[model samples]
Target: MNGENAYLATLMELFGRANFETRRPRTPEAFRLDPIRRLLEGWGNPHRRYAVVHIAGTKGKGSTAAMAEAILRAAGYRTGLYTSPHLHTMRERIRIGGELISPSTVVELFGRLRPAIEADPDLTVFDILTAMGFLAFAEAGVEIAVVEVGLGGRLDSTNVVSPAVCLITALSMDHTEILGPTLAHIAFEKAGILKPGVPAVTAPQTEEAMAVLRQVATERGVPLWTLEGWRYGPEEVAPSGQRGKIQAPDGASWSIRLPLLGRHQWENAALAVAAAIRLREQGWIIPDEAVREGLERVRWPGRFEILREEPPLVLDGAHNDASAARLAETAAEVFPGRRWGVIFGVSADKDPMAILAPLRPLVERIWLTRSRHPRAADPQRLAEAAQALGLPGRIRSEVAYALEEALAEDIPVLVTGSLFVVAEAREAWAAWGRMPMPEVDPIPVRVGGR
Candidate 1:
């Protein structure tokens, strides 16, 4: 194989050998920066060499981080973006300036770091990947690195950075087992990223979550800026899911346009813009035009993404209640008085009722299918769960079969409930359309585990 293919194969060989989720998962020992710190120490602490923006939240974190990266990139900064649980390729998790690190790069990094990784077999896959991102960004000489918290912020591998400005996106309850059972507990986990005197930009959150965040910020003496305080409401909501004349933190406002659908995204864009502006205040020097250009140019796939135009195949990875509610609300606003078919699947750990309860009213028919991932809830079980909610749906074992059935009706199909499900559907769609879904080895874990 060539360099790229060789690198890809090497990554597959490395991660494919270990169980990603269950291997050394849920070790919440108090925020030890040692794993990354040690790896960085071995690699000469590359993460410290670059300025960073650390983002942590229950929801909208990825989108907000992507927006921040886009804004920084638009402003002519050599940027590195690291997000988690990629929808398509593993390379999607680590990128420098919109280009994914080559497979050869991954192979080379793994080879270089193998001695360290092998010495400590206790480290999770995420920790090693986090190291790779830092090393890659450092080697590439990126000016700024936008890091998204992989799991709960307290013990997540990505929390090692002392960001220039920390951003907490809209908070909600999802990772109850690892983060916490209550919103406050979860908020505390998200707030773990706050450092002494670092300014934080956040979107409007629940009174409970906000209270905890405020308490944390107060104790740390870190300034907290709320997106709600940033003014300007929607001047017009177009049928095409576009908004006009959004107000900024400054007295001057601009007509904001986002390619992504949903009003929640408008809030997310506002948060990104607010965070970018705050970064500028901290000596980044990003222009207003760059902010506008970034917002317009931002592309977060699998979040209210419209894949096919003719029949309107919409894909959203709203795996939990808050995201599902947002998806339902956005659908109602974007396609008012219209019903769409839904191809749904979610992880076994997720509260299926919480997700489907709000969505059932809007969907014409539900095609339940299990994602190819091991953690995916069985389609039959999901269908039963929906039925318990009085929203009956058909079950299919395979994703492609369900997609075909949903598409046969010629109505708009909304594929959602889990990011893994969305990714699988996208892969199937790509295969069906004769497009290449970059070849990666199947994670060694069984479909439903051993």
Candidate 2:
């Protein structure tokens, strides 16, 4: 029996227990599924007690999973949502019906898991979290669990389930070190969630990526649905938010006003609608009203999130090249003809230039910074790369200070390059009691020639 403070410390210790999430240690060993499977089996297989909606991808995985879970909750079902790489708190990684898992849940689970965890000392923090998610969903009596893959899907700890419907969002080249270097190789790793006789859906993918997905789905005897048949209308962009329409091949249409503003939000929303329609067909009993409410209620912070309006600050966790390019496009759309000052920080494992190239033309100037995360690249190193790439930027060392430096320029500010950067900035904004982006507003038309 522990108090809330002790429970918080225990969670921190559990996170620090694994070198996988925080410290960018060299490839210590191959990712194994057996430990998590065995742990769950020992716990009476709690994961098997509930239906699963598994999602995996290089980008948009978290957003898509959040959307799915929200839809489930809005439809009046008890739902469990699990996402990785917590922005602020470890409890954010586990949610039941749109709320963070209670500290009591953590304390109780710790009590039950101590023996199994102590017995198998090799289980990673991710493994323990996966086990906890299963147990939480089971204990909460959730009807469905929306589980986001922590990394590549095949060997990812969350892949143990044969989901009712599996989803693979837009795939790109992130986590190439563990997954693979090329798009096809990465696609193979993401496609690992496809199971026999289960329906799977994917966003529009590249020829190379699509070929691999089709091949894998075929080999797995899965019925694959492609987003090619889906059409998402362009967002009527606004400072407050965006409104868009999504039409599935089955003629399920939804006009949604999304609060999570960005380039790819509509596409992500469309994917969610498609998955929901499939879930309805599978007898989930979700109605159109629930879908609309779910889309409106869904909040995925740090993905092109508007934090304030005085200087028009945006916090997006666009860490990879594809996401960075989309961020640039969305910024151009939102703030037409307006130059932006960007505060950028990225992980060491990422290619800073790939992220910077697409973003360069959109940025007036850059403030390079390092996040508190150990995987953050050195600010000096990022500044050197930026100058060599002809993108002018200065180093600020700390993420919050860099944000301040960027905000001082009196232009719209963008904090991107990593979620870790946005997470750090968000903590500061919370401390200052800055208001959040308005839920919904119309897009103001901008004329050229400032």
Model 1 per-residue lDDT at 342:
89
Q: Which lDDT tens digits does candidate 2 get at residues 262-347? A: 75877778878778878888898999999989988998888888877767899898888899999988888887777788898888
For model 2, give the 10-residue run with minimal summed lDDT: 441-450
Please report how far candidate 2 places residue 31 from its true position, in Å: 0.2
The candidate maximizing lDDT is 2
**Candidate 2: residue pairs that collide:** none
TM-score per model over all chains: 0.93, 0.94
| RMSD in Å for all candidates | 2.7, 6.3
